[model samples]
Target: MPVRHFDFFTAERRLVHTNPISLLKDTRLGIEGNHWLRKLLQNHVKEPAVVAMGGIPLGLRAAIERELDLLK
Candidate 1:
């Protein structure tokens, strides 16, 4: 899965392509309640390419964690 890393705080806000699984885990652990991250996930949901690559962005990761917590 291809993951794109984006830094909104930067002047250019360039995207850095990376591996999706590692990126998702890092974002899930590092960032919390970030609207930009959430927006990125939502935008990806509409496109088949993003979803096809097993894209589980911050929002989905959070949701999965929440579900696991509830199950516990």
Candidate 2:
């Protein structure tokens, strides 16, 4: 699949709830109007699934998106 840039403004802010065995559990990384932040997490985290909403950034999102494959 082609890696498409996420629209921060259009995107929804949320959290990613993980299991006790999961290090990502309670690790908040969701936000709106901040594509960079979402991208950053999308790249780094194994499964960048939103669990809750919060403040997000652009640089961070970009970083995450860059490492998205690595997360997989």
Candidate 1 lDDT over 1-72, as tens digits, reads: 323443444436645455545445534453344654466456543545555676454356665566456434
Candidate 1 all-Cα RMSD: 11.6
The candidate that achieves the highest lDDT relative to the unseen native structure: 1
Model 2 ranges with Cα > 4 A deviation: 1-33, 47-72
Q: Which candidate number maximizes TM-score?
A: 1
TM-score for each candidate, following the candidate numbering: 0.24, 0.20
Report lDDT (Cα) of residue 65, candidate 2: 56
Alpha-carbon lDDT of model 1: 0.50
Give residue 4's lDDT in candidate 2 (0 to 100). Answer: 57
lDDT per residue as tens, model 2, 1-72: 423543432355533344554565567654343554444466654433334444453355556555554434
